[model samples]
Target chain A: MQLFFFKSINLSSMEVFFDENESYHIIKVMRKKKGDIIKATDGNGILLEIKITSIKSNKLIGLLLKKMNIKANKHSPDIGICIPKKTSRFEWFIEKATEIGIRNIYPIISHNTEKKKINYDRCKKIIKMAAKQSNNFYLPEIKNISIFKDFVVKKQKGFIANCSNIDSKKFNEIKLYNNPLFLVGPEGDFSDFEIEFAKKNGYVSINFGKQILRSETAAIYICSICNNANNFNL
Target chain B: MQLFFFKSINLSSMEVFFDENESYHIIKVMRKKKGDIIKATDGNGILLEIKITSIKSNKLIGLLLKKMNIKANKHSPDIGICIPKKTSRFEWFIEKATEIGIRNIYPIISHNTEKKKINYDRCKKIIKMAAKQSNNFYLPEIKNISIFKDFVVKKQKGFIANCSNIDSKKFNEIKLYNNPLFLVGPEGDFSDFEIEFAKKNGYVSINFGKQILRSETAAIYICSICNNANNFNL
Candidate 1:
């Protein structure tokens, strides 16, 4: 069953209205007619089973048959990482992270991989598709690009994954509290200054084992581990 | 230092030779002339630091300056997954799985995603590149695409990850004696027949969590968990 995205729906009224763009997709693209059954999520934990009731004035209207809330109360990982130079690599990271279930994703410009810009619309579309594909109702917020130094200072504390191999703690040994934010480094890894600064501020250094992984790979791996942790729920 | 691939090299000979294709890459593509140093691995366990001693007759020859073993002795998860329809998706799985460290990789043809033939050369290239990118010396062996029933009937047992919520064991709770093989399902998940057949043959059903993951994501997630396990090493 394909899951569609509904930005907003009136649950109490038991109605759903698709805008011009979505209407075109439903009517023209998908050829969904009146009485067609469809499932959609509002990205705010609400999943609605809707039956297309009317198509008028280039808009699609439906009556909500059922409503289900996907509990988003679970404290999952919110990732903060330096984006890779390859657009596909970074996009792949976003797709996998969304599928694996994350709360928020922050693209950090570090000393190594700095000043990389990500298209917000593209990221959002990818996230939406991944969520729909993976049956995840909670849409992770994509934050604007932030300087590494500024991000660390502002977030205060989290787990930073690096390749320094100095005083690094195994992932299993680390104490995961609520809403853990992972700070993964770029290609060459975080600079000495960046690591030291984060550590001083309370970001514990962690490694996903001994192998050296790509920036995007590291980010997704972090998500995988977080999703599988005992206390966590996706 | 760039990591190159050596299909076979003699340690006692204290010399390295690049074939015609590799010679073209070193001399033309990479623009590495005599006296230039390079690092390579035999994709078994040995990493070598070699210095270009001669470039003659379209062959690149070097003297081995250093030799180190990557220790392939540690047991790790060997993944057998039904190949995804997208070539890039399967390639991504191979790359991430290699980076995260796997003992062997099998692309299986199952009921749902049936008989998808993977390009062995392309997969091997990706695996080699991933191993080099991750600085992993133990290159994972990419096995031929095996029939699902034939595979289960032969292998006898492994952990099968599916969307089915039946009597699943948490990954941490699963006993990992050595070289645990992970069978991850395709997009729609394994056919009920496949799951039941495997179970009858001793396969334990497992789920990653609540979220449904892509076949590639599930394969990579299994690798991540295996790498972080206490007894495993990359």
Candidate 2:
């Protein structure tokens, strides 16, 4: 089933209207006509089974047959990863992280981080697309870039992923808490000073074994592990 | 330290030679000169630290200063994922699986699989690139595509990832054996017949929680879990 995302819309009513772009997509792109059933989401944990009632010149109206509210996953961890210098890599991280059920993503800037500027709007679009594609109604919150020091200080408990020789704890051994955050460094890795600062502020050093994964790969791997550990309650 | 991949080389002696492409990269691209130290791998669990001795017109000669053998990760899982119709997604899976450590990859063809043809040579190149980039000397063995039924009979253990409502076991609860192979379906997913056959033939159905993930993301997620679970011996 294909899902389309609509933002800033009240879906509580029985009938709803789609904007110009979504209307064109439904009528022309998808070749959907009257009485066609479609799955749509409001990017806020709501899934609607809609029936096309009418198609106008610039708008399309649909009647909601059923609504399913997916409860937000409280166990999903918060991921604070340094944005890589390459835009595509960071975008790929965002897409995979959204698909893997991350609660929040904080793009941090460290001393060794090469990329400083980020296109926040483009990242939001990627996250929205991935969320819709993955059948996730709740979009992962994307926070503004923060300094490494400032972000570490705010976190009460979590692990900082780094490959330095600091006798870092293995990820599986750590006990996860609700809304726990994991911090991943840039390609060059966090500077020694940054790691020390994080360690002093109650952040445990965690290593992903012997493999030297890229910054984006590390973030996605950690997010996947956290998702599995928390959602394994089933 | 950056590691470069050199195929089919002898590291027993104190001196070694680089092929034309590697020579050009070292001498022209990297602007490396004599006495420069570099790290290189043979893609077969051998890491060599060498110092450049001379730069010939077509080749570069280097004297080995140190040699280290990275033991193969016996815990990495064997991934049997269907080759997705989109080449990029399948290629992305190959690259990430290599970085996260997979002993072997079997590209299977099922009833619902859209794409049938696969370029084995191209996939090998991708695995090599990813292995070298991640500092993994043991390159994953990429097998040719096989029929779905034929592939399922050979594996007695391991789990098949699917979303059907059949009380699939959670990944964390399963006891992972050595070199376990995980079967991930294509975009349309394995047909009902395929799923039933797999279940009847001793393959446990496993679910990665409620979120619907893409085929590639699911493969990487499973690989990450297996890597963490098996390598946590520390």
Candidate 3:
């Protein structure tokens, strides 16, 4: 099954209008014809079954036949990661994280963070494409960039991944939290002071394995493991 | 401890020579002093504890203080994946698979295989770097590109991930194989004939999840899950 994403859906109108990108994709690219049925999500957990009513030059109008709210994945973890300097690496992380089912993404800044700017528009587009391809109804929110100092004050209860000497449990060994959040450090890793601060704010240190992982790779690992441990709880 | 990769190791000499890349990284980037102890892996399950003896412009010399054969991970899976056309995607797959502790990689070509060519040297370098970063002593073997016809004849017992209608179990639910081999298809996916042929050769169908994944993403997902399920068999 394929899924398309729309930014918004008006319940009162009972009609779906394809955006410019989706219109071109549905009409010219996919060659979807009028009266054809298709699935679409509003990226807010609403899945709509639409019957194409008209395929104009730049617009493909559809009548909503059915709509249902998708059940949110209870095990999806929120990932707080130091944004990498490389755009490709961050894009790859966004793609894989969406596929692996992430709840929220915190593009954070730590002591070692070199790149503080992100192309939010491009990132949202990538997220939308990934979510559509992955058939994920709920779009993961990309929280505004937060400095490690400010982030620790939130008192988020989850694991903090760092390549430092800290008494820790293996990622899979830790008891799953209700709303798990994983904070991954930058290439240089979280400084001793940052690690201690996070620890004081109720974040427990956890190790993915013996080897060191890149910031983005570590976040993906945490997401993958969280999905595995929670979705297939045996 | 950070791990470096060496192509080969000599037991008799009890001496180690760092190549230009390693020498530069050790001497320039990391700024190691004389008598500094560093770890090196030959990618053949051997680990060397080396002590810096001399440093030069393009050469770093070390004495092998100790060497030992590391135990191999018994549960590492062998992945047979159709090569993606994009260089970055293929490179990303190699890096992540090595980090996830894949035993071997077979770059295969199926009915829909588009790009048959691969830069073996570059891929090997990526594997080495990822293994070193992940502290993996054993390097994953990158087999020559095998056609699906020749690949199916091997009679490997493992799983094939496809979006076709096949009676399948969740990857975690399926009993783990001794040395798992996962065959993932290309963008167009394996043809119906190929899927049946693979089944005849003892490959079972397994689903990663409900969502569709890109070819490289699927391979990485399989590797990640295999590592998680095996390493944390609790």
**Per-prediction TM-score, please?**
0.90, 0.89, 0.93
**Cα distance off (Å), candidate 3, residue B178:** 3.5
Tens-digit lDDT track of model 3 for A1-234: 668875455668877887989988877877788889999987878899999898877687888999898777677899889989898889889989997789999999999999999889998988988998878888898889998888878855768889874687666677876558889998888888888888888999977665577877877777776666655752
Predicted candidate 2 versus true structure: per-residue lDDT over A102-200, tens digit per residue: 888999999988888889899998998898778787889999889998888887577899988576887777888777889998988888888889989
How much is A167 displaced in model 2, in angstroms? Answer: 3.9
Candidate 2 residue runs with Cα over 4 Å from true position:
A6-13, B6-20, B23-39, B48-69, B154-157
| lDDT score at residue A196, model 1, on the 0-100 scale | 91
Per-residue alpha-carbon lDDT of candidate 1 for residues A1-234, written as tens digits (9 for 90 to 100): 667776567768878977687678778877889999998888888888999999997688899899888776355788998988888988999999998878999999999985489999999989988987888888889999999988998988899999877988877688777669899899888999889999998899988666888888888877777777732443
Stronger candidate by DockQ (2 vs 3): 2
- Give RMSD (Å) of candidate 2 vs. truth: 2.9
Best candidate (score: DockQ): 2
**Local distance difference test, per candidate?**
0.83, 0.83, 0.82
Worst 10 residues of 2 chain A by lDDT: A5-14
Against the native chain B, each candidate's TM-score is: 0.91, 0.90, 0.91
lDDT by residue (B60-151, candidate 3, tens digit) is: 88899888988776678888999898978899999998887789999999999899999999999999889877888889999998999788
Root-mean-square deviation per candidate: 2.8, 2.9, 2.4
Measured with C-alpha atoms, the lDDT of residue B16 in candidate 3 is 89
